[model samples]
Target chain A: MNLMLPDSGLLFWMTIIFAVVFFILAKFGFPVITGMVEKRTKRIDDAIGAAREAETRLRSLAQDQERIIAEAQAEHGRILKEAAEEREKMIVAAQEQARAEAGKILEEAREKIQEEKEAALRDIRREVAVLSVAIAEKVVRKELSTAEGQKEMVDRIFDELS
Target chain B: MRKMLVIFIALLTFMAHPVFASGSSEGEVDVAEMIFGHIGDSYGWHITEWNGHHVTIPLPCIVHSSTGWHVFMSSKIEHGHEYEGLFLAEDGRYADKIVEIGPDGSQVRPFDISITKNVASLMFGSALLLIIVLSCARWYRKHDALEKAPGGFAGLMEMMIMMVHDDLIKDSVGPDHRKYAPYLLTAFFFIFLNNLLGIVPFFPGGANLTGNIAVTMVLALFTFFAVNLFANKHYWKEIFWPDGPIFLKCPIPILQVIEILGMFTKPFSLMVRLFANIMAGHAMILGLVSVIFVAARIGPVIGGSMTLITMVFGVFMDCLELLVAFIQAYVFTMLSAVFIGLSRQGGHEEATHDN
Candidate 1:
C-alpha cells in the first residue's frame, strides 16, 4: 500500500527538486552543449565548402596552363617556318646579284684588252713609215752621182707633178 | 559495475553469518521488515548492528503539525524513543511515518519535510549528477568540441548524453524536440543517475529513489505536461474525434472515450513501469539475501550452502538490476519524448503519413 500510494510531502519535495534541476539544466547545461555541437557542425561544413572551392580553382589553373602551352607551341612553329622562308629568299637574291657582278667585270676586261692591241698596232705603223722614208733617201743619193741624168730626172718629175 | 556492491553485501551476509545469527537470537528474522526497510524510506541510515548497538547516521526530522513546526534530529526518536511528543509510528497504516498522539487520541501525520533516507539519497544523487555532468560540461567549455573529440570521463558522458538525446530523445520528440529537450534530457539523466546510485550497496546509494511512486509520479507529470500542454489541435481532436467508424464516435463516443482515457493512462503506465521495474529488481535481490537467513534456521550445513547459492543469485540479480536501471531510464525518457511527438503533430497528418 505504501509502495503504490504517493506521499504529498515527497511529491512536494520532488517537484521542488525537479524544478531546480530542470531550471539549472535548461539555463546552464543544455544550451552550451548543443551550441558547441552546432558550432562544430557548422565549422566542418565551412571547411568542406572551402575545400571544394580550392579544388575547382586548382582545376581551372591547370586548364589555363595547358592552354598557354598550346598557344606557345603554335607560335613557335609559325616563327620557325617564317625564318626558313626568309633564308630561302635571301639565298636566291644573293646568287642573282653575284652573277650580275661577274658579267660586268668580264666585259670591262675584254674592252681594255681591245684598247691595248690598237695602241701596239699604231706604234708599228710609225716605225714602218720611218724606215721607208730612209730607203728612198739612199736611192736618191746614189742617182745624184750622174749630173746629166739628174737634170733629165728632174724635168720628168716636174711634168709628172703637174 | 555492481561488483563493489555485491562484494560488500557478500562480506556482510556470508563472512559474518553469526552476526546475523546472534543479531536475530531473539527469534527468526522478519523478512518483510528486512526487505521493506531496505526498499522503503527511513528517518536514519541503518549502517549495521555492531555489538547489539545499531550503528546509524541520524538524519534531520522536520515536521509541521496542527500545533506548529517542530525541527529535531531523527536520533531523538530512535529505538522507539519519544522526542518532543513525536515518534516513529511502529504500527497501523501510518507505520514508519513520524506521527504524534493527536487530540483524537490516535496518530496523526505531520506535514513532514524531513531529510529522510530517500530524500537525502536523492539530494546526494542529484548533486553527484550535477558534478559528473557539470564537469563534463566544463570540458566542453574549456575545449572546443568542434575540432576535438571528448575523451576519458568527459567522452563517456558525452557519448551517453548523445545516445540519450540523439539516438533516443531526438527522434522521439519529432521536429519541436529542441523545445522539449531540456526537460526530457533532465528527466532522463536524473532517473539514470539515481537509478545507478540505488544499486550501490553503501554510502551515497542503497536507497530506492526512482522506484518510489512519488518520484516516478513527478517524472510522469513532467512528461504529461510536455505532451498535453504544448500539444497541437490534432492531439485533442484525436482524443475527442479520432478517425473511426461513424457508429463509435456518434452514438456512444466509445472510441473517443477510450482515446481520452489513453492520455491519462499513457502517463500512468510510464509511472508504473519505471517504479515496478526497479522496485521488483531490488525486491528480488533483497529476497534472495533474506532466503539464506531464513533457511539458516534448519542447520549450519543448509545455511552455508544457501549462502553460497544466494550470493550467486544476489550477484546475478544485482547485475540484472544494473541493466534494468539503464533500460528503465531509457524507456521513461523515450516514452516521454514519443508522447510529446505524438501530441505535437499537425491535424490530419496521421492520415497522410502512415509511418
Candidate 2:
C-alpha cells in the first residue's frame, strides 16, 4: 500500500466519535473516580482536624490540672494559717483560765488562814478565864471564913496597889 | 511480420536512450508542454494562474490522459470535506499539496485544513470508546456484586482508573478530586485513544489529530475556561495581589499587568507544547524519508547503501514515536489537571460569565 495521508472522511468521523466519547466519559466515568479521590482526601483532613482538636483538649486539661493544683496549695496554706492563729488563741485563752483559777485559790487560802487565827484566839481567851477562876477559889478556901473578913482583905490589897 | 519487428526494434532503442541526457531534442517542448503537456494530453490535470501563483490542484493519484488533476479552493473546504489535489512534475513525481508552510518561514503556516481520510480515525476512535464505555455500561447493568478489585477488561480499566485516582487526582488535584474525577478520566482516555490512533501505520489513524494546532488550541481553551471560571478568590489573589509585603508585588502597576498576562499565557503554553512536539515528530520523519528518495535518484551504487542506512534510522525513529505518543497525551492531561487543581484552591469559587 502507498504511504499517503488519509482522506477527509476519516477525519470527520474521528471528530464525531471524539466529541461523543468525551461527552459520555465526562458525564459518568470521571465522576466515579474523582469521587473516590475526594473521599480519601476529606478523610485524611478530618483525621488531622480530629487530632488537632484532641491535642488542644489535652492542653486545656493540663492547664486545668495545674490550676486545680495551685488552688489546692493555696487552700492548704490558708488552712495552715488559720490553724496557727487558732493555736495562738487557744494558748492565750488557756493562760487566762489558769491565772483566774490561781487568783481564786489564793483568795480562799487567805480567808481560811484568817478564820483559823480567830478560832485560836477564842480558845486562848477561854483558857485564860478558867485559870483566873481556879486561883481565886483556892485563895478563898485557905484564908477568911466570914464575908466581912474577905471584904476587908480585898480593900487592903486595893489600897496598897493604888 | 517484418514491419512489426522493425517497429519493435525502434521502441527498444527509444527506451534505451535517456531522454534527459541532453536538453536539445528532435521535439523541443514548449512552455505548455513543460507544465500541462500537449493540449490533447489525456491527463486531466493542469495549473492555473491565481494572482501570479501557480496553484496545482490534483484530482487523483493515478492521473490518466483523459482525467487530469482536479483543483479546490478555500471556499470548497468545509466541515465534512472530501477532496484531493494532484500535480504532475516532469521528473515523473506526483506532488500533492499536503503541508501548509507559514509566512514566518519558521512557523507551519496556518490555513484551512481537513483530515484527508476521516473514516479510519473516526472508526478507530469510536471503536475504542465504544468498547470501553459499553463494557462498563454492561457491567453496571448486570449489577454484579462489587468485587474487591476488578477482573478481566473491567479489571484492566479499573487498574488504570485506580492509578488516575490515586496517583493523579489524589496526588495532583488533592482529595477533593471526587468532584472532578470524571473529567480527569475522560480526558485521559480521550487523549489516549487519539494517541494510539495516531501511531497506527495507515489510513485515518495518522491524521495527527492531537498534534494539530487547532485541536490542541481547543483543548487548551477548555482548560483555560475551566480553570479561570472555577478559580477561587485565593488563586486569583495569589497571582495578582499575592500574600506578602506590598513591595513584593512591587511597581504595583507593572506587576498587576504581568500577573494578568501570566494567567492567559499559561494555557497558551500548554497548547503550543503539545502541538509542537507532535508536529516536530512528523517533520523529522518526513525529512528522513526524503533522504532515501534523494539518494535513490543519484545512482544505485551510492543510492542503494544510503537508502538502506536511512531506512534503518527511520525504523529507529518510528519506535521512538510510540513512546512520544503516550508522553504527549500524559503531558496534556496532567497540565489540564494542574490547572483545575489551581481553581479549587482556598475554597471560594468564582464563576466566569463565558461558557
Estimate, for each residue in B198-285, the C-alpha lDDT of model 1 and write its tens digit: 8776667878888899999999998898899888878888898888898989978899889988999999999999999988887887
Residue B231 error for model 2, in Å?
Answer: 1.2
Q: Model 1 chain B — which ten-residue stretch has the worst lDDT?
A: B13-22
Q: Least lDDT summed over 10 consecutive residues: which range in candidate 2 chain B?
A: B35-44
- The numbered model that scores best in lDDT is 1
Candidate 2, B181-298: lDDT as tens digits: 6656666676667766655533334445566555556566667876888677778777777666677577655666777898889888987887677666655654555565456567
Q: Please, what is the whole-model Cα lDDT of each candidate in the order they appear?
A: 0.83, 0.57
| Per-residue alpha-carbon lDDT of candidate 1 for residues A1-162, written as tens digits (9 for 90 to 100) | 798988777788888888897888877787667667667778989999999999999999999999999999999999999999999999999898888888888888888888887888888788778877787778777777699769978998999999
Candidate 1: segments with Cα more than 4 A from true spot: A66-162, B1-27, B347-355
Q: lDDT tens string, model 2, A21-136?
A: 76777665545434443455577778889999999999999999999999999999999999999999999999999999999999999999989988988888888788778877
The root-mean-square deviation over C-alpha atoms between each candidate and the true structure, in angstroms, is 4.8, 18.7
**What shift in Å separates residue A126 of candidate 1 from its native position after superposition?**
8.9
Q: Give per-residue lDDT, candidate 1, residue B179.
A: 90
